[model samples]
Target: MADTQFSLVPKVINGGIAGIVGVTCVFPIDLVKTRLQNQQPGPNGQLMYKNFRDCLVQTFKKEKFFGMYRGSGVNLLLITPEKAIKLVGNDFFRYHLKQEGKKLSLTREMIAGSSAGACQIIVTTPMELLKIQLQDAGRTATVEGSKAAAVKPPKISATSIAMQLIKEKGITGIYKGCAATALRDITFSAIYFPLFAHLNSLGKRKEGSHEAVFYVSFISGLAAGCVASFSVNPLDVVKTRLQTLTKGSSDKTYTSWMHCFRSTLKHEGVLAFFKGAGCRIMVIAPLFGIAQTVYYVGIAEYILGIKK
Candidate 1:
């Protein structure tokens, strides 16, 4: 029992560190994904940026390089706890759900992953709200025309945004799209964790190691993340739109998740649900690859002198 308790501490630390590393590495791609997902067609039915590459180029050219990292500060700050809760929580549930022989069935794994996904939404919602706000800020400017270019982008500090959200809409404002966020995350973890585990297990270096090499873990996570990311991208798009849309914006407002879904399908067509699928795959692939490798490598254990 003591050993089990001791082992759990490392999972939390490693998960947090992995999140920082992964988010930092793929934030630019994630920025592009957010923009692509949130953008709607103009009057002529032309989109702001044609594709991920176009979005990346335009953002750099217009908003400059730092523009690609608009919400990185708050994202990085909140990602630690968010990931700690997710990865650690998954492991916690998995440990508890394991059978007498320390075996976890696929069903149990999915349950554990789902539980972790649900647990993280509390942090994920507000964190994502702030992130989407900052990420979509540039697009908001473009949509508004002259007034947008004339005025400087608001210096969106986390503290300021938090204060403003609280003053205007209270804590609820920070969770604008909780339902969509939950759906996306739950589906992602349900697919990702079990798939990753199966792939990782197949590549284990030796019996009892219960750990794949860095490359194996990386590849497993990348593949699983891409598949999982693409699968739930529609939900992701809805979540992004719901979170970023201003209350009284010229664009349509989504009163609920179903409204967002039906409205998007009706107006944007089916393909709109997949606007950022490619970029999302790219972002999630590396994000999970790095995260899985980092977690499996147990670097945090060595640093913290917690290795068994």
Candidate 2:
């Protein structure tokens, strides 16, 4: 049976609230994941962070605890719309794809997910660019060594960054990594939704029990997110690099997504693609856990007093 029938407004509200909560809970791990993904080995084959723990320790030591949340304001702000489009759009498309009383085929589910992922890119690109810029700021400073410390860091408001990007490269600057973002997100959603659905179905609870649905949703989302996030880590790495803004350099790094892929593989080897796999799994697992639980629980419907 279908889990629930939600109107468009309720779907959006549910998605937005779930996204905010999930992202807020996992932003720190996300920051670390980005930093890990963005780092390449030096001539001596040394990495800035040996592993996730090292990255966490060094980031906190250098940038402080609050620094872990550097780009979270913009992320939290944009994630609402981004996730609303993703979750609601998924259901919207799934509704159309479903034949009455028949479960959606795996292919149909994947198509629905891909559509949702593609739809969110319009908002995701700019939001991600801003967030990556902020999250990678400390890494850039660390790379620059003492010289970076001499110069003060830019203030951390999303408005200031948006204004600066517009001034520097016009509106197009905000969408610096659109291609990579679309590629990663599309692949991720394609994998995530279908897998989550299958897993959730395997562990289905009694019909109309919200509590059972909530717990099952959390477990399924967590499992699906870890697998999907790891599978797409290479694409995610390329996206992070493309979105990140470097200091005083107007030039693009690695040309295009294909170029970025080729360069990373050639230079850093296959293992480089999974640089932040652990941290990414951690971030995504909990993120989807919280998000899916909240979404399934129908808190938005309850708060808004819309009957299911």
Candidate number achieving the greatest TM-score relative to the actual structure: 1
Please give the clash total of every predicted structure, in order.
0, 0
Query: What does candidate 2 score in Cα RMSD to the true structure?
Result: 2.7
lDDT of 1 at 88: 86
* lDDT by candidate, in order shown: 0.85, 0.85
**What's the TM-score of every candidate structure?**
0.93, 0.92
Give the per-residue lDDT of model 2 (tens digit) for 1-308: 55556488888889999999999999999999988888876556666678888888878877787888999989999999998999888889998899888979999999999999999999999998888888888776776565225333456677887899899999987888899999999999999999988888777675755335677889999999999999999999888887777742322377788998898888778997888889999999999989988887888789889867
lDDT of 1 at 11: 84
Which ranges in model 1 have alpha carbons more than 4 Å from their true place?
1-6, 146-152, 206-208, 247-250
Error of 2 at 254 (Å): 1.6
State the weakest 10-residue window (summed lDDT) of model 2.
146-155
Lowest summed lDDT over 10 consecutive residues: which window, candidate 1? 145-154
